[model samples]
Target: MISRISALIAAVACAATLAVSPLVAHAQDQQASAASAAPAEQTAAPVAEAAAPAAAAATEKKDNPYSLGNIIAHGNTVDQAVLVILAIMSMGSWYILFIRLWDTAKLNKEAKEVRASFFKKASLQEGLKSLSETGAFRYIAQTGVDASEHHEGALTENIDHNTWVTMNIDRAVGEVNSRLQGGLGFLATVGSTSPFIGLFGTVWGILQALTQIGVAGQASIDKVAGPVGAALIMTAIGLAVAVPAVLGYNWLVNRNKAVMSQVRAFAADLHGVLMGNRKVAGR
Candidate 1:
């Protein structure tokens, strides 16, 4: 009887153990799934965060208020006209600067050639031939020669050969100088006036801005900043146009002085040759 009672207790305990084991295994599986999903959730969070900045950048690009397009679009007719005038002035200044630079370079090159070959020639005719036909030195030499040869003309008879030759040489030098100085005035004008023109634009822009502010009855940064910035851009443009023009003008003027010195020296030597003081050949 004791053995049968023991056997019945063992069977009941085994059934209970079998039922609890399955529940414990299911709980373990659920915990394992949750642990694996947590890492994936954390990794996905960083990806979402990185994408947000790119979206914001796109939004900012679309709303840029200070771009040139916005300036032109919001500007008045007079403001646009001022910009146009500034552009035209800038264009003219650059054109003159480049053209003058090219002319100066050409003249300097011709001057060098004259120094190297002209004085080495056997006679005045040979020297003239050696020089570039379009050169200022050749022109001055020809003028002096003509004055010496044509001293008998009624218009020139009152002047002695020396005075006549000097006058002709001086006149020729003046002509060359005038040609070299052709665009300098325009450059000066642009440099002096561009800033004022820009200031005019600024004034006009500010007046308009003020008018709008008065109408809007508000002084917020958003309302005042855009127009004010656009107006200031005119001043900046003017200065941009002026500074280069001024610099180019000064540079060209200095270079002109150097080139003219060479020219005057050539004219003086030619004058001496015409006066029979300096022989063309070494003999």
Candidate 2:
């Protein structure tokens, strides 16, 4: 009878174990499913975040109102004309500045060559040969030589040899001075007028803004700011064009003065030699 009771208890315990096994397996399956789903959710989150910046960039591009496109598109005929004029002025000033600067540098280089090679020669004839054939110094020297050689005719009877040579040297120096001074006037004009031109644009823009305000019956920031700002851009552009021109003009002028001073000193010494007032080393 005890063995039959023990067998009955063992059978009841086995039945209870069999009933709980499926619940534990289901819980484990759910946990595994959740673990697999978490990785997919994390991967999808990064993709959504990456797309957000691209969307914002596109929106910002569409909403940008102060771009060059807007300035050109919304501007009227006069405003566009003013912009064109300022552009032209800026272009012209820069072109003149660069060209003049190149010329000045070349002249300065030539002056140095003249100083180093010209005075070392023993005689005027040898000195002439030492200078570059096409140089300004050579031209001045040749002119003096020719005047000295050719000053014995009826045409030159009134002027003495010394005066005749002096006159010719002066003329040659004047020619070089004119060449060095080229394009400077344009720079001055641009510098002096660009600001006023820009101010005109600003004034025109303000007038238009006032008209708009009168028509719309409102002085709101949106209405007032856009036109005023665009107009102010013209003034800024004008100033930008003007400042460089002024600075360049002054700089070129000073460089020209320095170059001319060297040339004049050379001329003076050359004159002394031509008139027999001073002697070269070999002579």
Candidate 3:
């Protein structure tokens, strides 16, 4: 009975060891899997973080073309003088553009109405009266009519017909052209100067950046980007101001030229009409 009991107890202990061995093997396998997975997860975490910044940066880049905010972010690099010049150019250009546009439209409309009325009736007095109601074109129209009327009367004052006609036509054209060209000189000046002003600002900024780079003892993208970027803003802003002004200046100049041409033509036609009327009345 004692021998049987000893064998049975040994068998029970062997069974317990066998069961614990599988558990230890499973735990080792789990720990190894965890160790291997931890590096992948750690690597993946950094990749995800890196990708987030790239996506965000791409999104930001897509939103703005000029990215004025970026230029402003590095504001300290820009000179105050450059900023002031840019502001003045921008405001001045826009103001001239709007004012000149309005003037051109108004002049064209009034000239059209006057041309239609004058051609329809051929009454100089009626045309002048109709023109005066509009307030602006009356100056041009009245100058033409008054000069023609004066010359018509001067024909009786022993003045030569051709000389009197030529002199009054010259006076009328001069006055009309002068009024048409008013304030246009300033627009041209501003358009021509704005780009150079912006260039000066850019050069100033670059000089400042170089000076800083010399002091920093290292010339890297980080050190050079701010001042260079700020300098470029001035150049861009200058162009922004100059391009429209130049375009507007040219456009207004052409429009005024056209209107003035029409006025001169009208003056010539009026001179002929008046001369014909005087000769007809005399006959």
Choose the strongest candidate by lDDT: 1
- Looking at model 1, the pairs that clash are none
User: Rank order by lDDT, top first?
Assistant: 1, 2, 3
Candidate 3 local lDDT, 227-283, one digit each (tens): 777678778888888787778878878888887777767767767776776788789
Q: Is candidate 2 or candidate 3 better by TM-score?
A: 2
TM-score versus the correct structure, for each prediction: 0.75, 0.76, 0.64
lDDT of 1 by residue, 1-283 (tens): 9999999999999999999999999999999999999999999999999999988987785745655577678667887888889889899989999998888899899989888988788888999888778777878888888887777867668777678889989999999999989989999999999999999988887887788789889987777777788788888999999999999999999999999999999898888777774343325
Cα deviation of 73, candidate 1, in Å: 4.1
Whole-structure CA lDDT of model 3:
0.73
Q: How well does model 1 score by local distance difference test? A: 0.86
Worst 10 residues of 3 by lDDT: 61-70
- Per-residue accuracy of model 2 over 37-110 as CA lDDT, tens digit each: 99999999999899999889877847335444567887788878888988898899899889878877877888
Off by over 4 Å in 3: 1-78, 134-137, 148-162, 220-222
Could you tell me the lDDT of residue 134 within candidate 3? 47
Our model 1 lands, by Cα RMSD against the true structure, at 5.4
Number of backbone collisions per candidate:
0, 0, 0
